[model samples]
Every structure is written in structure tokens, then in C-alpha cells.
Target: MSSAKLSRRRVVGAGLGALSSAVAGVSAGCTARSGPPRRLLLATGPEGGPYNAFGAALARAVAASGSRLRIVPVSTAASVDNLRELDAGAVDLALAMADVAEDAALGREPFTRRAAATALARVYVNYTHLLVPADGPVRSLRDLAGRPVAAGAAGSGVQVVAGRVLREAGLGEGPSPARERQLGLAESARALREGAVDALFWSGGVPTPALSTLSREVPLRFLPLDGYVGPLRERYGPVYTAVTLPSGAYGLAEPVGTLGVANYLLARGEVPEAAARELLTVVFDRWSDLLREVTAGARLEPRFAISTGRVPLHPGAVAYYRSVYG
Candidate 1:
């Protein structure tokens, strides 16, 4: 086998071995308690997005695992909305972009006060997508100046990154600033197809379903944003990374460079330790199942999951990881 395939198998095998040990430890130490299952509201992204799909799949997987915790997926505006809902005590768990979560933790722009949110795991990475028509006049970031662009839906992580990217490109607040529209992924794709907007921004898993379908209907192109990663990291810490959208996605003839941000599963500081631990137990045990609904090449390995950067991990997650690594 090729070295790449062999390396992937080694990683997967090691992760699964660690997960098996963790599960065995849990089973041997815990005793059955007779009671109603604990229900948790997981605030996910809008319909058709990776967050929403993964949330639903996770709920099913947890249920199938026979765990006492029952996760209910609640669709929201994604990242920022998920964080706000988590802070408001409206949800027990949420999925958010690391950058937006950091802003909430630090009480940065768009957040009035610091939030008491804790990370369960760094689940996946989202690629920044700057999409335009294959035959449109928007050949570069400069071409977007003074043009209408769907930035992202209000209270979404995409909006936070899109604004920063545009500002860095000098199209945010200049003589010819790009007109911004607050449209969700579905709406933005439709708007682009109908020529209502010149370009749209999205941050989601590779080959986002909406964009993939839109690409089939109307030829689309992804503008490279790799150049902005360095500047963004220099200004906003290390939340952004340079990544590439592999060729063939959206029917691209060649790979397109872009910025990537990690996505995290977060919980309110008040969630019970037992419940938190149980939820993550199932998460790690059923990691492969969760990946089916996430992005291509996604992994739920404990090493990767624990790297939440500045966002503090929940105490329960800390305990769980200790058990896995110990």
C-alpha cells in the first residue's frame, strides 16, 4: 500500500484502540442506574449545513449506543448563534467556530460580555469559501469592490470571518466597499445563481451540499483566500490556518487555497459533570459514525479533539481525556 494509506490506517487504528480502552474503563467502573435518560439540547447550525447534519447523526449514534444521555439537535444560525444560545442557558450543548468562540470568551466585538462556555472537543475544520460565478467579472478580491456580496446570515460565524477577510482585502470600508447581504447558505447560493449577488462567502465542510448542488446547476468558482491567513493570524492570534480545497470539489480544475478555522463542541459551564462525561463517552465511541455527517477527511481522535486552543475544556472532558490517555 502507498505510504499515505498506511499512515492513515495507523492513525485510525491507534485512535480506535485508545477509544476501545476508554470504553472498557467506563464499562468496568460504572454501574447501571435505573432512571429516565438525560436529555440535552444541542444547538446546531441551519438546516442542510454540516453542523446540523452532524448533530442529527450524533443524536442517533448516542441513542444507538444505549447511553443514558439523549441528545436533541436544535437548528440555529450556526457558530455565533450557537454560542449565544449556549450562554443564554437555552441549550445544553452547541457547535461553534473557534474564532467566534474565542471572541465570546474574551468579550470581543459582537459580544458585549464574556461568556461562560467550555469546550468539549475540537470537532472539525471549516474551509472559508469565497464563491463566484465561473463566468463572472469577479476575478480577484479587488473585483468585489463596490459589488454586492452575500457575506453570511446574521449571527453566524461566516459573517465574522467574511467581514474580517473583506476588511483585510481593503473592500470593507473604502471608497468602493463591497455591499454586504445577510443571507444564509441556501439563500446565498440561490442569489448567486440568479445574478442577484456577484459573490457569496461561506465557511463549512468541504463540498458543502448546497454549494455542491449549486455548482452542478450553475458553474461556480472558489476564490483563493490563503493570503489573508497570515495577516488574520497576526491580528487575531492563531485561529486561522492556510488550507486548500482539493480539486474536483465544486468541479474545480485545480486546488483552491483558502483559510480554515477549527470547529468545536461547547457546553455551558453549569452542565453536570456526569452528563458531560457520558455525552463525550458516546462521542468518542461513535466517532466514526459522526464523521459520516461531517466533512471529508474529518477525524475525532482524542489528540485532535483536545486541542481547543484558548477555549478551556470542560472538566468532564478533562477527566475523560485523562482516562483515555492514562
Candidate 2:
């Protein structure tokens, strides 16, 4: 095996071991009825975004876990802004893109230095969707040139990936037919309805609520990432993946071919061991119920969530994973 693959396995094993030990310690140290629930504050997004829904589910999970968690809805644009909030200690937890989380910990690109934070869990993959009015002129990515495009909310990972996709499609250059606007999916959908924007690009999960609502009201068209997946992965590394947003994901006319980025729960380097243990239980144990509240929550299984931690897993999360998977 290649060195990278070998290294990945070793790290995973270590994370699994650490997580198991932590969970065991937490369980051994206190009885459920006697221990005081840890109070936690989780940060979410403004509204109508994946972060919002996912954060809500996480809060619910913590509550169900018999823990005291305050879900704080913070206005965020994802990536840089979210990481900044985390770094400044404005919140205890937040949903983040693994790509951005990686950069934040290392303090690279769009960030001045390493963020000193760590990964808690890999929650779900973010699929980028290019939605247009069914009867609108554009059909394919190539057709987006010089057309008005809403590139997701400003500072959002959606916008970042949208810009990358546009660049890959040769629309990022001078005098292109495409004009990229920064707006959330709901706002973009409204703009498309009003003919203010020709298309909307969002990097999120399948069946995104706003997109689903829009598809019901208007004829929606999906533009596939047919030929650009490999190139995107090459440029962005493992952060990009070829994912299909299946038909009916949002009452869509058909499935959308797209690229994806993984979402991760992030924490500061020194988050308490006891807190991490409890947090992990809330995430792994009640995943199904959590998913019912947030679609992404349902996808947070150990086989998937724990397998993709590129950075060092938080010792707390590590402890939880080890108990189950080790």
C-alpha cells in the first residue's frame, strides 16, 4: 500500500482506540442517574441552509442524550466565518465542511494561520447542485457563460465551491457570460423566480429544503458535473467527490450529477474529554432519530462518519468511536 493509505489506516486505528478508551472511562466513572449533564452551546446558521438543519438535529440529539445543550443559532457563511467563530470561542460546537475544517486547523488559504481546532466527526457529504428554470435558455454548464448565477451565500463553502466549478467550466475569466451572485438557496430561488438570477448553485445535501420547495413551484433543471469530477478531485484532493443527487431528491425532474465535499463537526483542540465522550454518544447512539430531524443526521453512521477523518480526531470523539468499532 502507498504511504498515504498506510498512514490513514494508522491514524484511524489510533482514533478508534482513543475514542473507545474515552467512552469506557466516561461510562465507568459515572452512573447515568447520578452524573450532571454537561451544558453545551452549539452554533448553527441563519436560516435555510444545511448548517441550520444539521445544527438543529445535533442540538436535539444532545437533548435526547439527557445532556443540557443550548443550540445557538449564529449567522454564518460557512468555512472561514464559521472557523473564526470557533477560534474566537464564540461557541462550543459548529457544523463545518471538512475541507474548510482542514484548512482552519492548518490555517491555510483564506485563513492566515492554523486554527488549532480539531475534527469531532465526519457528518455528511455536501453535493453541489446547479439549479435553473426548466424553460430557461441554459442547459449545460458550458451554457452558463455570461448568464447570471447565484453562487450561494457569501463566505459560504457553497460559494467557494461554486466559484471553483465556474472556474473549471471556463466561466471564471474576463467578460464571461456568467455573473456570480452571492445568495442562499432560498434567496437564489426567489431571484430565479423573479428573473433576477438565471441559475442557482448550492453545495449541500440532496433534497435540500429550499430547492425542493422551488422545484414544486417552478420547472427546475439540473446541470450535471459529468466531465469535471476527476479534474476537481485532482485540484482539490480528496475533498471533492462525484455524487449523484438522485431524482425526487427535491421533486426534481431528474437526478443531478454533481461534485461533493464532506461536512464535519469540529472542535477546539482542548475540548474536555468528558464533554467529547457525551457528545459522541449523542451523535452515534441516536443517529436515526437525529436524521429524522435533519436528513444529514441519518447518514452519520460509524462506518461512514468515522472512516473519513483526515485530521486528528478529537480525543473525545476518538474515545467514543473506539468503544464501538475497536
Candidate 3:
């Protein structure tokens, strides 16, 4: 990371420490016409998660676009927590999984109070990683019936989908057949290397740096999830999609079928229309730069931006698209 990038991330981390006292004032901030908001807090995922890197890239791009709207990217527990933060007025914007944004839109579990927010864009896709020891006996989801698994930490989007994968595989019940250990990507990778778990479910962008490092020691294999893509989408929403992890990713022997969920840029309903417009303008206008900076940004496409599941696109995003394609 460049010094400027490091400085930008530090600013976000510092802003996070001061947010508790600033929640009540988020809605009162400035706007595009009124000059710029004091700052826009973007709740991202954990340190090593894709959201963190992606959000940082976005923050930099928006800043460089000469927009007064400053996006401060902050580390968070991913989707569930980001929604809660949105509802709590602790953040103005966030990057969330499409499924999680849908859950909030419909007032589903983990979101008892519905958040008034909308998707700004369909940012990217998070591939489901059903990682196992290369030498282990596990070959597919069905084989994990009586084994140990790391289902990602609680409150993370990874955990939510991992739990669904287990339930759909018939491993959720029957005397706790699959003992799930709530672990984050880094911790889970560590556990896997130490022979502490039979398999781990990690949902992230391809070539997760931490996992790539772990793979160096433990050699790995992927358990396919293509069969569950349809079922997951039917049960959850349109966010679940089929994706193939290409061969050579994580040094795998061949491509692996998997479930992929769209990631979204979300903003509170209170955000001014012009502010939202300007922010997204920065995103789409300098998209190539964004893709070069954030690996996940490589998955962004305008065609898919409007199909952001139940969480409809913000008026600003729609207006921006209208001007371009119409």
C-alpha cells in the first residue's frame, strides 16, 4: 500500500473511534450542493476481508474524483453489523452482501428493526470457499455429515451462508452432526493448518491473501456448491448465483463449482439525492482505476447494478444510469 493509501485507511480507523459520539449527527451532515458532508462513514468487513480492501479503494477513488464527499472506510463485522450500524445512525454508507441487504430490506432475522436504506450498486461477487485439507477425506458438502467445520464468525455474512450450506446439506441437525466452530478467515485458516477442523467455509474474493498463505502449508481442495445455488436463491433471494472458482486459484488443481453472492454499495435513505449521485458518478467514471486498485472491483458491471435484489437502487444511481444509457 502507498503512504497515501495507508494514510487514508488510518483516517478511517481513527474516524471509527470517534463515531459513537457522532451517530446522532450523521443525518445532519452537509451535501453535494452544500459543499461536502463532513465525512461519509462506510462500514466495511474485517481487516483481511475483501470489503476492507474494496472499501479502501472506493474511498480513494471518490476522494480523487474531486468530490467534496469524503468516504471514510471503517472495519466492521461485515453485513449484519453494517446494517445495524446503518439503522443506528452510526454510518452513512456501507458495503454489504446482496443477501444481507435483502434481509434488512425485508426485516428478516438479525435485523429486527428494518433499515431505510437502498443499494447504490451491485459492487461484486463473493465466492463460497468450502476449503478442506488436501489430504483429508472430505470431498464434498455431503461428506461433512459428522465432521468439524469452521462456519465463520458470528454476525459475518460468511457465517450466514455457511450455515445455510450446512442446513441444505442435511448437516445442520441430527445431534449436531457437523460441529460448527465460529471462526474468521484468518483464525479458520490457522485452525485448518493445525489440524483442528476437518473443513472450513470461507466466503471471499478469489485468492484471499490469508488463505493463499495458509495453502502453502496445508495444500487444499474445494467442495462444490453448484447444486445448492438454485436452492439457496429460492430460499434466500436473487442474491445467490452460481460461480466457478477458476483453476490455479489458491493453487487448486482444477476449477471448482461454488455459490456466489453479490456484494452491494448501500446508503441510508436519508442521504441526499445529489450526494448519492456524485458518489456513484465517481465510482462509474473512474471505474477502471477502481478495478485496478480493488481486486473485488474487477467484478463490477453496470448491467448488474440495477438488479441488486430486494434492496432497490437509490434514486441517485438510477438517475446516473439514465443519463448514460438513455
Report the error of model 1 at residue 1, Å: 52
Residue-level lDDT tens digits of model 3 in 1-326: 11123345654564554343343333343332355354787878787577877676776666555566767777777888787777677778988888888999999876776777888998767888898988889987888888889998877888888888899888999865788998888889888988899998988777777877888887788889999988887888768889998888788788989999878889988887888888888788776665553353365578987788789788887887888767
Clashes of 1: 0
Of models 2 and 3, which has the larger TM-score? 3
**Among all windows of ten consecutive residues in candidate 3, which has the lowest summed lDDT?**
23-32
- What lDDT score belongs to each candidate, Candidate 1 first? 0.84, 0.69, 0.77
The alpha-carbon deviation from the true structure for residue 91 of candidate 3, after best TM-score superposition, in angstroms, is 0.3
| Better by TM-score, candidate 2 or 1 | 1
Best by lDDT: 1
Predicted structure with the largest TM-score when compared to the true one: 1
Off by over 4 Å in 3: 1-37, 292-299
Residue 160 accuracy (lDDT) in model 3? 85
